[model samples]
Target: MTLAGCVSTPHPEKNTTAIPVAPEPEPVRPLMYAAMPDERFPIPAVKLDQLDRRFWRREVDYQTSERPGTLIVDTPAKYLYHVTPGGRAMRYGIGVGREGFAWSGRAIVAYKRQWPRWTPPDSMVARQPSLQPYSIANGGMDPGLRNPLGARALYIHEGGKDTLYRLHGTPEAFSIGKAVSSGCIRLINQDVIHLYENVRDGSPIVVVPDPSMSNIAVSSL
Candidate 1:
């Protein structure tokens, strides 16, 4: 008694054996972007590489003393957490300032902007002469895909003074989960749009300083 059932196999006719298999209807490519705000110039959807998924935005169980809607940036881990009521937080991948360029402190998202304009700071212009033309006088880079500030910006302020550190969007999706910014925190464009539409202004922002640079306790977050 053969316990394994014998599978029937088809024998190809030697006389006419070429069975044409219909080529897999090319896999439907997912729509990269929705209707653009400007019909003349559409925003192309960012094609994500497999590596990005490892740092992709996601919601996970997170225990924190902070209340809901709190924004905590983990500079070391390159992750930002938006605390929720429950023991959960929505986390996003981010790019932070490089070694000497990093800063840390407590601040608030005092203001928000959509398709915000960007003017390179004088200091930045001094560093890069190319940006000299776009200083406060000449008006900075016009808001668009090529703009370093991708789609939105969350102004960080403390005691009514601008920290010059922003939580903003970047067209450079590949920069996620890395240290490569002037001093601001950068998220993927699509990720920022999702965050901008949800995170409220006045939300608390705590920039977690790079531990290698400074010992700022972030276990609380």
Candidate 2:
């Protein structure tokens, strides 16, 4: 009975059926966004607390051909979903471009930045000459709580060409679920921070144009 030299490999349970236990849903934390997200930035700390609960970030059941790790932005629905395994997604409220500024297409997250500085484009400076001070020539707006770009920015690109669009955080929580931005997609600071931490660079993104194309899913648990 010399069993010391023998090694056993347990066979996988090939005949067993898989029973998927759904994940429990998490509640949206009230102050996660509006209050001070970080101790360093003090200017926009208090505004997000007044934001609507529906706009808060949460996980939900979803349906789409886009595999897990793909990000979908439903422009008309004012929501962005990060697809996950087992028919689930993490959804975040968003503010899109107003009217003529709205656009829909495919793009990839080319890069990401934390507390990014914003330089007013030449066209922007032309429309609001006062912004000239923050133009490329002036070194742009310094990254801070008061900056329009907010806590994080995900640069979107298509076929190696810059789309000039961004998924970014904003201090203005009131803008969530509305069409108000010049063109960039906006989220609450806390939500954006969460997204920035989760998504990997070069992930594919899909922007569905109309509400009819949106597929809303409920969260389990």
TM-score of 1: 0.78
Every candidate's lDDT: 0.78, 0.81
Model 2 Cα lDDT, one tens digit per residue, 134-186: 99999999998788888889998887977778999887878998888877899
Question: What is residue 36's positional error in candidate 1, in angstroms?
Answer: 6.1
Prediction 2 global C-alpha lDDT: 0.81
Error of 2 at 166 (Å): 0.5
User: What digit string (tens of lDDT, one per residue) describes model 1 on residues 120-218?
Assistant: 888889999989778998988788777787788899888788877888887676788888898889987777877888888899987777778643322
How much is 89 displaced in model 2, in angstroms?
0.5
In model 1, residue pairs whose N, Cα or C atoms come closer than 3 Å (at least 3 residues apart or on different chains), thus clashing, are: none
TM-score of model number 2: 0.77
Clash count, one per candidate: 0, 2
The TM-score leader among the candidates is 1
